[model samples]
Target chain A: MTNKTEKKGFSRRQFLKASGAASAVAGGAGLGLFGYEAGKDPRTYRGWENWEGVNQVFNRKKYAVDQPTCQKVGPTRRVDARTEVIFYRRGSFMRQWREETGLEGMEPHIQEYYRKNPEDLELDIYSQEVIFPKLMEDRKKYQDQFRLSDAWSNAMGAVSPPRITEPPEVSDFPRRSRRGGSTEPVKFKDPKKTSKLIKKIAHELGSTLVGIAKLNPDWVYKYTSIGRGFQSDEPIEVPKHWQNAIVVGTPMSWDPMYANPNYGTSNDAYSRSRIIAFRVASFIKQLGYAARPHTPGTDYDLMVPPILVDAGIGEQSRPSIVVTPELGLNFRPAIITTNLPLHPDKPISFGVQDFCDHCKICAENCPSDAISYGDRVEVRGYLRWQVNTAKCLNFWNSTLGSMGCRLCVAVCPYTRKSNWIHKAALKVTADDPTGISEKALTMMQKRFYPGPEPQKYYIPSLGGENASYREPPWWLRTEDFIE
Target chain B: MQFFISGWFWFLEGILTCLMVVGLKFYMEDKGIPMPFWKWILFGLWILLAGFTIAFVGTSLGEGEPTAAKLGGILFGLTSTISGIALWRILLTGRNKT
Candidate 1:
């Protein structure tokens, strides 16, 4: 045979004996997978079927917040002044029709009701105006029961740095410093005295949610890099000047983030957080103060549970992460620290704990089985749900190419899009705090919605050339547009 | 002897590897060879290293020295040339009819 023919027709036996052995040696030396055995073959692609570990790597113990905190953080409502009214009534006649019909309709009575009771709709007689205030009152009343502090109230009134003159006993908590205190000290401060200006600036920089809280060492991991203040042989002392933290959250786009599970989706989220961190930190620095942006690669400090809870952003849920009411687990967070005085937002509770007690969509959908199935257990002086970090991380390592698995977050019922119908159920859930909310949520998941579908994997760089799952650019082809 | 090899060439190897992987995935798909998970694992590692190499070289090539993050923003651009060339070649060749 010719040389080309000889090479093309090479036997598997000969290939195995010569090149395969060499490739195995090189693969072992390079990536450290065990040298390929003669008969042991490996499967190429299992896609989401073999994917596990969505919860493990991210939900590890040191990072896990208590479950009640998760619940408290999850159901937080956006306190926008612009509220929508679905049903309106004019006077006793409209009220009687509402009682009689029990539904919204453009009946003559309803139309007359709208004409007469436009002011009543403004008054929001049918719905309570002070739901947030009521929830805050309830949260304060049950603070110790929930294993929380009154950090929100304390962080208010802080416009300038906490000087020797302004409230000397800044509520005795020896945590990290405000400005990388000697590179790694606790920098948490009274949530009350944080800067409203900083909060506004953070919002301008794309932060939809913001909060402030005092630092706590226990909330931080037991150990971290010396640069990060988990624990170091170096002497740990709280900074004298720096106190108070500004927690900022940038909500992920609900549509793309929920649909795409991999880093492609999350990388964009992380990138946004990094951007917000830079902007907020820089703004503080411009005001002739010290501001540190706590982000993944940039910050020198560690983020504990306070950033989520103290901000009234969301509650911690079954997956041991803060769940926002509007976007669920579809957001990334960062923190800024300085001496700027500002008002801190109070912790919010919208019945997420009671809601999660009956809802386990995330737990059911976790491919790695890393999320817990048991009841809330106490860990690190707080009762909370816990996930197996090792299992989650292993799954991440296994599925390197496909977007890192986010099956748990994707399947979360709370992560659904905001619509009027859902708002009604949520309002009732907030009012009751009973398992009715959970049942409604479950019914919504089971009866109203289709089951979880696997996320698709396609190479973005390859675009439409490889698989046809590319996100089409704005301009459609003439053929596609015509159809 | 090791110093004789250009660092740019290491990066070029990475760029070529990425392009070849793309080609291989398409080529193998047309030929019906199921790609193993290791191919993807290798893909991630190579992409990361290539990114690092670009940042390191780009920093030294500049006046103030660019950060890895800044370099990361443009690493895809640099690789786009080779990948784009490969894509253009494929476009010119028309669809593979395997």
Candidate 2:
């Protein structure tokens, strides 16, 4: 035998010496008996087989206003307008700060970024301190390599609606004119029927998830932004007619989204989301109901996660993005406000909070270390794992293209793609009364799916190859485009 | 290390070690070889380690981490089984009269 290493390491006699000893212990515990059968799985939610956590509507029957699940999330608090992070160009926190502090008072190096993008939510002191300096340094250090990264991101396609301040005309389906009280509004005698129709319309319009929730004024931004943009100095109030909200969510394209910070644009899913919102809002308006679509990135008036929770879309996970059992963290949303009188869906629970508590893969894989490693904290009266956005945005802009990162989104165990096998695993994980399967599954993710170190995604010295979850698909092929 | 698991090299190693350990026991018993008390305990540990490695391998295959996790457990499991067998053999040759 040419395999001397094996031959010399263990002779036939040596093998005989060991197996005899092993039989005693191996015989005691037979290997064939300790597995599970999907058919006989004890995990059923309300007798729903293999659909334990499949739907996004976790808002259980007889929904609790204060506590969605057995877990006490604490007293719910409305987001204060004064402290809310406003990303609209006119109402941006940086815009307010610049108006008050003046650009002359700003650091000269970072003044360029704000001047170029005043409404950018990430344009803050952290960008000035950590991100801009790195940008300037990378600009000089890896000129063509940096350009290549930008080209690769651009080749995947630019995130649409480049400017946050784009007028409502971005939606081609605008209402004919401002609605008046002079005409009797078209009434849906049965709100439940109308809601069902709206949901069907949303799906037909390409929504992956849709739900009706009464507008929670607490989630609405109070100060810098308004229900609509272009309002000047006067503090604004939500119009009385802005009552029921229709939240439409779209899943991000699978291959590109799984790539995360490397080739993925965090905003890609939102483009589709916003389109669905525009269509749904237009449908409501044509039916003679007052409707206003809050475009995802460009024109939303409120923080999204809480409203998503209220709408029964999903529960917010550790990264603070709402994770539905259907799409996990892969959903992007657009909200339409109207007085359409739809039956409101209550908040849901399907063990997302519980799954998040045990599965720290997102926290462990975060490139920016932006995701919280600690337990959920009560912020503004709601319980959540608060992401340090400063750390997150800094890592995002530090990358060459300034394409935002979704490393958290990509790594989240809940973000599993829907398939029969994954669905079975998810159901087991969701309804495992013993929690044994969840623990084992979490262990599998932690052990088998190791990703590269954080710096590999952005650090020019490292060449960023290991950054993607898998290689870019054929269209995003680097060699075909770059070389 | 990664390749060993990815290629299922460790599973081969673990299974071979387990067979070798168990095979040696029957051989000794067939020849009426008088192993000492401490050697018997050492022999039991070899089987125990191999049994656990096989259990992890079984669980990994069931849990849908078929390649790296399953093969990796088997690979490292071989190391533990080999060590137990080696220690058991050393105990058999030891000067101590237990």
Candidate 3:
């Protein structure tokens, strides 16, 4: 019976009524939206304030850890299956680099490889097209990116040892306990407390994260890469004193990380991480425990990711490295093998498996199309998203200025810096109870953070110029600030 | 009260609401399009959604999440708000039998 014009007028009473209803609906939805995850995390997760009080805002659930992709659960290979020592870098063209100090030709190593495997064609194409041209071009003109990349490496290399060996800092000369001056190793009545102390000490020594895992011979490498062009030929065995392996991690600098697929970020994180490894190893030695640090550049006798997963460092992602809930893809791990009594942490899951299934931002943005857009494939004894490391490295060599391409790392939604809004969005997406949020979140990620043409990152001759995820920092590239 | 306070709801919401109001006014008053009552509600809701997008952009920017994401979001939110206003103008022009 209400007149049409009166209805169109929107009376004051009707406006107030609609406004009250909207306020009530919005309030109720907010209470429900936020109230769901409250009081769930009984433990007060410390520091890195963004993750603090996160539960009150976002629904984050830390589920039980899953088995790492590298771990061949329920052993299939015997101790002496194929004695010629599996070189982890066998496929990587890095093995072909001319010298211990990189940025050189791989002509001789590539010829030797063809002699060994007549069927190997991937590296053949890579060398002919990418590496040879890069080295030839390197002589003519040195780009600003390569110069910046070399500067970062040289800075780190200033402190780097020639080969992988125990740092002098990890000596047992002061083995006598400060409390008792006892020559005997300090004894722990409870392994749990020792584990806690180890973590506390590692954190105090500037470790971003610390975890312990039992030594798995399966994760140990047959031969250790001591330095470029030098790897131990004799079988590197996990020593008897090395019963527990401590995995410590630190996040990469976000400033440089924003401009990844460039030289500024990766080694910067590793330099800090490798030092943390030595410090933790030294602390164990001071406790009269034998320990060995396997650092980032050339010191590892173990597969870092599998051991990191074994120690509950993080869950494996589509890109194959472990991603932590706290740091996401912006993390690097350093391991220390020791005889110290420490509790092992179980593998953890933070919903990466499901999230990566739907989100292909990394694969889509990879410059050389190296990251797989296909479904997870079973390779070796485990399943993972297989990437052409040769193509990836070739892109690294061909990138206008740098020798490393972290395009995949830079574009990943998980590789975000720790902030409150990201915290909430990531938490909901990780919990992903409805399954709808994952798809919705991925859609939003693509829309808001849309990638440039992947080809834009290639060399000029290769049909693209160096368009980056974000511009490199001003200090590194002199042109940015120069008059 | 505790949720809104520690959770930074008011700070985020209060800023975003002001942005939404400004965004809606920026578009709606351009040609002085006479809004129908229901169209006003739809226009308001669309502007509110765009505010959410802006809030998301600012939060992400502070976190080193991608520069492209921030720029795209600002572009998309402001453009979409104008499109929302234009949508209503088209409908009002459609009622041209007078």
Best by TM-score: 3
Ranking by TM-score: 3, 2, 1
**Each candidate: fraction of true contacts kept?**
0.00, 0.25, 0.06
Rank candidates, DockQ, best first: 2, 3, 1
Better of 1 and 2 by TM-score: 2
The predicted structure with the larger lDDT, 1 or 2, is 2
Q: Each predicted complex: what DockQ?
A: 0.03, 0.15, 0.08
In candidate 1 chain A, where is summed lDDT lowest over 10 consecutive residues?
A38-47
TM-score of 1: 0.45
Question: On residues A1-483, what C-alpha lDDT tens digit does candidate 2 reach at each position?
Answer: 779877865676565665645544444334312321221122311111222123444334533344443233567554433333423332343444444566565544235545765544344655664566766777676545435445654543454433345333333223456654233367677999999899988877777678778887767664443434434344446667778888887766565666666667645566777767877877887776777777766466667787788887778888888987777788888888888888998777777777888888988877778888888887866667888765676677666542777788877877755533456667787677677888887886676656677667775633443366544556655567676
lDDT of each: 0.45, 0.62, 0.61
Candidate number that wins on lDDT, 2 or 3: 2
**Cα distance off (Å), candidate 1, residue A222:** 4.3
Stretches of candidate 1 off by over 4 Å are A1-194, A226-242, A262-264, A297-300, A400-403, A452-483, B1-98
